[model samples]
Target: MSQLQDNFGRRFHYLRMSVTDVCNFKCSYCLPDGYHPTGKQHFLSLSEIENLVSAFSQVGTQKIRITGGEPTLRKDFTDIVRIVSDNPSIHTVATTTNGYRLAQHAKEWFDAGLRRINVSVDSLDPKMFYQITGENKFDEVMRGIDAALTAGFERVKVNAVLLKGMNDKDLPRFLNWIKNTPIDLRFIELMETGLGRDYFQAHHLAGADIKAQLQSQGWSLDIADIDDGPAQNFSHPDYRGRIGLIMPYAKNFCATCNRLRVSAKGKLHLCLFTESGLELRDLLQHPDQQAELIERLHAQLAQKKETHYLHQGITGVTQHLASIGG
Candidate 1:
């Protein structure tokens, strides 16, 4: 099997595949209210997804992160994990979910070889959580987090998108909660993308500020050598779990990028902040074109931009996080 390397000398080994664009939640930063779902025919079938994963695995993708607007919302969610985990070359399989329905399938997902999970929980306060997610299912999501922990997955992470006047005030509460639990907590800086650019600009909070606040609170932090995607991880002396900061705007990690994204509609996105991609749905429909498709994919990856233009004061990709499989 040949390895896929970009023009910048980065070897791709991870793939984030979105199974569906449909989501139940209407997070203010992700999807707006009354967002329309993609048509069912646009989604790839189970066999097609498996085949695509097989193609990527053959080309040295060892880690597969199943994603979606909400991955568990897909009917074949468990099956998707089972198939991807079955790949001999794929050593790790994980998923990022909103955690609304994770409790019902956590055990099943664990049995299907899923070892890592990232759940998005913005606020611990029910009212604030509802305000941020635009949903009243905070209790359900909390149950889902507990279920993931109870299921005994190797790594269960909590992703909190920090906003200036919103959840940023709850950083202490988040730290206090994680200090007692085994799950790691990651604070992601608000990114300017799609129609949320204005909102992000208005509410964006720098991860550096958050880190400083934590330090001022007497939490000793030591930079840890841990690379999971682009997050800069740090360990606190008082906590059993580590804290992470994903500052895409303040400290971009594009130089060490090693993954690719496949949108739910089968488009191959080389960079999350770029609109350019190669359509692969037609290629997947023909089994005989597998070799050719792989070759084309490699070519497309080779042309990936050296870095995103967000830091240049340019608006990022116009696609919403939901459409991009965040």
Candidate 2:
């Protein structure tokens, strides 16, 4: 019904929903140090988001991921998850979070129907964490990770946004834990966005750098085959556990890009880094317009550009990571 596709055959059927664009910990890659929107923003009601997903599912889109400024920040997050997961057409129900609140919500989320969790745990060091996230809640975040494992969620992933002069050099420490623990640590290439109109061009971290760092540490690795998505495959030398790299910026995974995003405000974004979005708040508010919303989505998706120019450099990404729903 919708037609957002590149010259490549990959069709955009995945939906990355940003329930709320407000995050408690403002990470370097997510938001600028002191960036703020001029006007007050409103979040999409639970019903509004549900209707949009229901419409998308009716069309061939099967994957749905709940993203956020921090998804847990939403008071009705569990209710929202239940609505989408309850839909038979939705094969996967996942979320990308900061993990600051996962410990308390993991069990509830698992019971509600979230099968996959991708949490952003940048570094283990308290000092570095404070440096990266202008906050001091590392302990809480870790607690959430432990809780997620205990909650019975089968696929638990750790997404680390590798930033230059910040956490990239600490790969050995991160990967070391992955080798011992039964968790999959995903190393994401630092993306440019919201607070990143400038500033981060020189600090960009690429997937090659991550690979090189692992090689230098003599950490034997193998590319992982974690179903499908952007992240390049990588695995622990011998352990059953694995690691992933999402080089969406430099390498341009746009060829196999099959994802779409709906913001908390109800606008649907076909790509992560751009400003173009189709407002669905009204369509969701009006049931009769669901077809119109679906048709608009197809048209917008067909217009998806090749790659994101976030940081505005050879390897820069054009959009903000936080706004992109990670």
Give the number of the best model, judged by TM-score: 1
Model 2 TM-score (2 dp): 0.89
lDDT of candidate 1?
0.84
CA lDDT of each candidate?
0.84, 0.75
Model 1 per-residue lDDT tens digits across residues 51-161: 899889889888999998888988888899999999888988999998988889899999999989999999999999999899898899889989989999999999999
Model 2 segments more than 4 A misplaced: 1-7, 34-38, 213-227, 309-319
Cα error, candidate 1, residue 290 (Å): 2.4
TM-score of 1: 0.94
- Candidate 2: residue 17 lDDT (0-100): 87
Q: Each model's number of backbone clashes?
A: 0, 19
